[model samples]
Target chain A: MAYFDYLPHLVLFTIGTLIGLEISYKWHSEPFVKKKIEPVPLILALIGGGLMIFYAPLGLLFIGFVIGMRPGYGIYESVIGILFALILWVTL
Target chain B: MYYPVNFNLIYILLEIITAFIFGGLLLGLHRKVMARIQGRPGPPIVQHLLHTFKFYIKELSIPNTSSMPLYVAIVLAMDAVWILALIVGPILGGSFLIIIMCYAVHKVAEHGIGLASGSPYTKLGSTRAVLSATAEMPLIAVPALVFFKTDTLLLDGIINYQIVNGSLFTQLPLVALAMFVLVLSKTPYSPFGIVWGKDIVSGYKTEHFGVIRGVMMMGEILAFFALLWCFITIFFGGIITAPLAYMVAMTGITVILAFICALTPMVAPYHAVMIQWIFAILAVVNVLLI
Candidate 1:
């Protein structure tokens, strides 16, 4: 079967990640006001990245990067991002 | 043979409910065991469940320095990962690879919470958590070796192989030893628990309070159950055929772990990492030679 067959799985994963990020951005942002980089546009980028997972292993790496670059970036956060990327690359 | 994806939503729901309820009971039991080891009267065995409910009724407070979104996301994500791991890894006979992936995602939750908190203590905890993850990576070889022996990646397949050929632990004692070491580090109160030790005011959880803290606590209970379930399934044999055996083994291991934790002094993060690395190397050599 082609990797695209797993598109539903990828969509679910992307949706889960976006929901998680949007919740974080909405409730946790300082002043709780409108931000320049709202989470909706970012969700589109995440969907694009998730679709890319079918083309090459680098897709998960991109998704991980986007996740790490979200607000509240830190050293351990980046480390985990890389770890998740590597895991998805190897497993999926 | 791939089964049709029926996706019984009710089964999944029931499984999750049972896991959390039993998981909370196990956590409370662990606390009581630890208290007895320290010569103190412990709270009731249902203390953890009560505490979690108390947090639900309490006001939610977000620390000013914290990233609220990430904080909440980490807790919820951690709980989700554990639930999936338990259901898929052991219950539904999923691949060992998926189990490992779930574990990796769990580490992400841990790292995110510590980093999002913006507390120095949590930062230190996050750094140590990273170090621990690095050290724990080699233990993945345990499953790899199991795959080599069983010629299958599914937990059910491994259990069947044991039923036919003999226990994996007996055949591969060194891998069992390595897994024991990994389990020890994962257990609370161990020297490896510096991330949550008193020295750091509960480490990554220092900034979390009220309902959020409760969610984290629930995640922890579920995580512990997942680990213990994995251990019993992979090392001792399948819990399906031997439920009582698994329970006895779980209780025995918990008490022994608590005793070791009470007796041992907390080790520095560097020291803990070094020790795990040494064990990992030994496991590698064992896998290569045997």
Candidate 2:
């Protein structure tokens, strides 16, 4: 029952995050990688954040923080992901 | 449901004109402050206006290095979206609606411009822009949730909510923190300015010049007004009968926020990321409790 309460948010967060991760991964792996830092994880985080907006803004934000823990891209990505998540939660 | 015209052509024209003046002033003020922080008197507040005008009449430099038509088309499309977002503000029920549309359009337009330019700086801007957009998504959402539950997405809804349930800071202190973080990140100040700032040296706008760049600036200011209007509508009043009270209160708050953006040296991107998580946690806890 508790899980059901959070089901929509979680599903949206996961779907968005997964999409974000894949997009970020692809985006970073492109020839553009040599030109810039990795964007895959951050992109994943954004997708996750946006999805979370329609459900529980807070839940998505929490999920965003967790997904932000992926290694190698540094704090900027995590910060951006968290920020994006929060923005969607607050305003959307 | 019947909808009232909160914003219309007259209102939009007024808002756009105000945005132009206000954005120039803010940019100039920001520049001056940044210069003062670095020990110099920046250009006059009206300087941005002159810069913008110069860009308007300047020859549209069609770089043979790229497809001009596609580039122009993209910029136009982006500008149109942003304009639509801005005009919706006075037409919609309240400030939150304006903020959501404005931010959404701003992000899209920024990304479009970035891709269209295809320069290194522009690419960096585009990348940072995506990163910035990714960061702001959640921050914008949380506040809307509070409004949603109260059965209003307009400025009036927020004020009424405040009048009945008290300010958000009272009902949801944690979410308020999240809101602040969102404001900082979206505004791209010192700590959250990884994608913008002097380090990027023009960031996304680096490759742009003349009218293409001018249009982008116009969009940026419109977005800024949208942001300011949202802030006021949520925290203060949208279209208050007591205009003086609304102006005084909003001006005071806006000034404080502006000062914070100017005086504080930016934190590293790493620190910003850490702070984001902290605030996000707080916001979630607040929401769960609610």
lDDT top scorer: 1
lDDT of 2 by residue, A2-74 (tens): 1123334434444434444454455446432223334555565566556556656454644444342322232
**TM-score, each model?**
0.71, 0.64
What tens-digit string does per-residue lDDT give for candidate 2 at B187-286?
5354676666567686766667889878866766555545655555555442342433433444454455556777777665556556676777777777
By DockQ thresholds, what CAPRI class is model 1? incorrect
Model 1 segments more than 4 A misplaced: A1-92, B1-7, B238-240
lDDT for position B49 in model 2: 54
lDDT, candidate 1, at B225: 67
